[model samples]
Target: MAWFILIFSGAVEAVWAAALDKSAGFTRLWPSLIFLVACAISMGGLAWAMRSIPVGTAYA
Candidate 1:
């Protein structure tokens, strides 16, 4: 479960980056929203995964 979430989160990180780029300095509403939501999900997953996986291994 943790591994799945972690992997999903990693993939979401790419989406987050793309959204951030598409946000156009946050002037674009939809992309900005997607960026925020993706950031939250990615961070949340990373935190949750950290509870089960070692920080070093996860970071590596």
Candidate 2:
């Protein structure tokens, strides 16, 4: 469901934010990779969910 993907994406966004902090300016390899991958998944999920959900409601 679109709502499920949107919620999952939002949760991943938190992981992305935390991994970004752990990345140490991208100096740390593992955390940096995690950040990059999380970013991709979060954005991709948002895009996919948007196909079924309206942008305004999804954003809210």
* Count of clashes in candidate 1: 0
For candidate 2, the lDDT comes to 0.95
Residue-wise C-alpha lDDT for candidate 1, range 2-34, written one tens digit per residue: 999999999999999999999999999999999
lDDT of 2 by residue, 1-60 (tens): 889999999999999999999999999999999999999999999999999999998877
lDDT of each: 0.95, 0.95
Off by over 4 Å in 2: none
Lowest-scoring 10 consecutive residues by lDDT in candidate 1? 51-60
Measured with C-alpha atoms, the lDDT of residue 54 in candidate 2 is 92
lDDT of 1 at 35: 99
